[model samples]
Target chain A: MKYLLFLGCVIPYRISSYEISARKVLEKLSIELVEMPEFNCCGLPLDPVNHELMLTLATRNLCLAEQKGLDIMTLCPGCAGTLRKVNKALREDKKLKELVNGFMQEIDLEFRGGIVKVKHLVQVLAEDVGFKRMREAIQNPLTGLKVAEHNGCHVLRPAKYVGFDDPENPVILKKLIELTGALCLDYMYETECCGAPIIGVNDKIPLHLTGEKLRNVKAVGAQALITVCPFCHMMFDLNQPRIERVLSEKFGVPVLHYTQLLGLAMGFSPDELGLEQLRVKASKILNLN
Target chain B: MKNHDSTKPNSDGGQANDRKKEFGRTEHKIVLKASDLDPKFKYKISKIPGAERIMLCFQCGTCTADCPIAKFSETYRPRKLMRMTQLGMKDRVLSSDVIWLCAACFTCIDHCPQGVEIANVLRALRNLAAKEGLMPVVFKELVSNIRNTGYAYRIPELRLKRRAEKELPPLPKANLEDISKLFNLTHLSKTLEKEERQDA
Candidate 1:
């Protein structure tokens, strides 16, 4: 139950709350996370700019994890998706492996993909930490709280690459939400992109997409929106007010990382889970005094 | 959207005052001259991996129909782009601002009956655009950041301090020597240097 925690750039920079709560929840479940050492960006950010750069960088990270012989558990889906895609590609395609290794060899590394595995935190929770053990570990269940999920694009998408759940209708997050004893609500476009990736290019379209989701989430009377990616969390939580102002609609939806909800179910206090750091105040809906 | 002053990375255009200048540099006309069509353009794209199915796209419209960006954007149609690429409208497809709007959700990939993988083809097109040194400034900053710090963004100093305060292990320092080796071997730094000279 050990993994090298891959904290991509976003979690460390803008979304520390996710890291805080994820660490708390994983520790309670007895999943030991070793800090990944001397790794570069997972190569997603530069993918569109250059595919080779992405493949090479992602393979290099995989090699580092392979050297340690521990699977990678990432808080960010983008990191998990990129690493997994490259790992699979390099493993199956000899030519691609040689192309990536041509670059890896210069850096004194090799891409031996069969040795390591990359799993998103949700996958680790859903697959590795089975529900029966998790049910037994739950000291308190988040009964009566209403939350909906926004499983960001990368984790379940491009099904051929990182196939953990149904991409069209993701149920892993909903299942995990139910494990917390909170009522999981369904909202329109539940399995849609959060539009975080394109925010760097066209900010308005992303706001419109996120604003529409927020409007729909509010329409369904959800108390909070649960997300698994830091980028999705930013779009829904940190940018909630902005979305409201631009769309001329009010949606005070408190977005929580799925880990935070599970941490609460594990009886961890609000302060321990970094609930205070959320932009939209969640204490009232969460019934925290 | 012009009056909206924003310091965010993706606001109005990443690099200050460059959106108008960089994107859509080529003006596309509705009435196209035959010379605009590069007959071999589709072949050039299909040769690239992830875009091997570019010629197979039958314009099912499923990609644009399901694209979230296409819903809000007036111009970004993945189906139209596929047609344009196949029709050999290379310059028009390459220089269009709409191409960059895709969020790469892979919704197009999952739903396409032709196995066209529209998102991957879009990425391949974007890669070609990048080869011509036509890149957004945010990517330039990311390349520079990874080149300098081994991370995508230049993570702040205080955030590093806060990690220790919270009892988390200090953020791992990237091996710059190894990263630099990749950068040079891949010739990304050289490409970036050329881009910077053009930006200057």
Candidate 2:
């Protein structure tokens, strides 16, 4: 299957490994990941503040993807949720769609609500790649690593809206991890907040909440936490130290993108997955050399 | 607002007070102590040192409506959190796990009509929570892991060797000094000292 891969800001800039591993895994599964250039912010952060600007921004990205005649696959849950929401809402809201179209006219692009389908990489893998194929592709099973799944709020809550997984207890990520033969450790706070909302307003909340999520992962005796959202990855992987300094304590757990684990299981080396770019020391876990 | 005076006769009737006295006079006494406070005291955002524009909040639901996570989870209602912060009910706001759930989408800040910065308020509360030791235990462990490793994930040695094979940049090793510097930078250390003094 062919898909327009939107990396967004977090994955390419901070969570490069997520984008890399996702690409590697998709290629292995015989999925075509076409990179779309000149796509701006998903306008998600703008939506709550300015609906008009948000529509204009989101439609611009949709138009780019639509031009390629391919469905869009997003590794970041936030991107997937935001894109899917706007697309669906625009299709149903004619006035809003026209308003967005007007904005697009200035840029010489058109946004038709049904022009593209936006899906998370996990959804693509589960539905398109399939578990059986994933199992057959894995060279190293990640047998020893105990992983806890961190599905960001965007993927689940507002259950009727996102409609990807169970808001209370999402097992798709867990099932995908298990497919790699890694242990999916179930723990309290599995569905808890990672504090992504307070980032711009206050870095402290995300730090504190991310700290809490990491602690739960550690308490479960899991080796590390795996997530689908780059924002969640940033809060847990990039922002953990800020939280530690505030708390005056040490938590030994580490965070990873689900694709990073999948890439390793598929026998791809750390560098191939862009593991070096992480602020955290991810190399310490794998004996790739 | 009428100051809540428990010492005054119950507006409902003396029967309520008498019933409380029968159960235990202490209950009727409305025990007020420094320790009886909401353990997780949230600073009024307007009152937080250096955090401006908090007083502009008009209790509008624009922020709550605009939140990406709030649409998914009621636990992350930004408007409610803002209102709570303005009311000086720090304990209720600080103890809530909802504040920790925000994905920092910046959607709320963009949408808030009154210009009250909801996101910053959450940040301030989290910092205060850390100082008071009110932050969830899970959060404490995450901080510790990052302090020692520079990243939240615990990378196995095998992964490091593999990175070398792939020619990826080696992960940076964290040191005590770096972590200490970050700790001081957060200013949470000072908040801890201030909270301790308040307790004393």
Candidate 3:
């Protein structure tokens, strides 16, 4: 199956490893990724400041995907959530659609809202590439390697709109982790927000939240942590050392993008999956032969 | 407007004094005067999307309980904001630093039995506040980046050059004309203009 990949701002700007690894894994799974064109920031970053601008910008991207007639798959849950929420809103609300479309007229594009569907990477993998195929594709099961999953907030919260997995006890990512033959350990506050969105505004809180998750993951004897969203990955991996220093705790948990973990199971080397790009090194956990 | 004496509470009653004790400070003991409330602020916010269920909230602290930011932050309380909004505490709610602290994890929306999209309501409050030129500095920077580059942050030239060495595809170029027009149509351009003038 093929989908238009919406590589949202974060993945390109800071988290290229997620993009690189995901592309490799999806290619092996035979899922074609059509790169997005004329795409803006998915309108999520500025949603708080200007609601209409968010809608208009998301609508423009939706219209682009509608022209391609393929479902929009985003690596960033923020992009997937915003595009999906806006798509659903425009589909159900006529007056609101008209209001947003008025801005669309200036761009000379009108989106037939329901034509293009949106899904985050987790949803695409869990649904499109089923566990049966995934289990079969596992050349080297990561048995004995234990890791915890962080199901970034946007993927499952706001149960009314962007609903899929149980928001309270998310298991899709865990199940994905388990299929690689690695034991996915349970941890506290599994569904907690990474607090990445407000990093600049209040660095302390995100650090606390990230540090708490790392400690919890370490507490479970998990050697590493797995993430699906680049933002969450950044919080846990890129800022991990800083988080440890601030919290006065030392838990050297390597944060791997789910794609990187799956790529390892698919017989790809650490270098191929972009594991080397991680801030907190994964040298100890890359033991599957 | 300023009451220095916490012991000398005359009109609002002992509950106001008790409320002051909760904040742990004398100056933060703000009494809710009738003149300070708009009384129609809830209705105004109700007209905004995602905030349609604003009146359904019964001062439940579910939002604050489920909020991750609230766990570490002493001041950021979603339930208090919801109550304040319901009580028509417009100016105070808009000016609150806590409102900007919502990471929009949206756990509050899923957990709220009242079906109140608390995070969305907070965003609406922020959007209202932005109209009055009250967004945080980061938002100002983000607006500037999106206005100019169509990306939230300015991805450096070195990073763009590094993409090819890593065997990644070229990053999609943004349609600045359409983005700029949307910013203009949404009136975000004016907000940025106001923010820049203030900065200058």
**Every model's TM-score on chain B:** 0.84, 0.66, 0.85
TM-scores across all candidates?
A: 0.94, 0.62, 0.94
Roughly what TM-score does model 3 have, to 2 decimal places? 0.94
lDDT of each: 0.85, 0.65, 0.86
Q: Which stretches of candidate 1 lie over 4 Å from their true place?
A: B1-29
Q: Which portions of model 2 miss their true places by more than 4 Å? A: A287-289, B1-200
Please report, as a residue range, the 10-residue window in candidate 2 chain A with the lowest summed lDDT.
A45-54
Candidate DockQ values, in order, are 0.56, 0.05, 0.51
Clashes of 3: 0
Q: For each candidate, how many residue pairs have backbone atoms clashing (under 3 Å)? A: 0, 46, 0
lDDT of 1 by residue, A1-289 (tens): 9999999999888899999999998998999999887869998988888888888888888998999999999999999999988888888999999888888888788887689889999899889998888888788888888888899899898997776889887888899899888989998987878788888777888899999998888899889999999999999999989989999989888999999998988999888999999999997777732
Cα lDDT tens digits, model 2, A1-289, are 8998876645544566776677777788889867675545565543332234445556667888888888888887777877887888789878777766765665667887687899888888887788888889989888777778988776665465567667667888899999887889998767766767446534554566677677778888877788888888887777777778877868756678888889889998887777776676765567532
* lDDT of model 1, residue A98: 89
CA deviation > 4 Å runs, candidate 3: B1-25
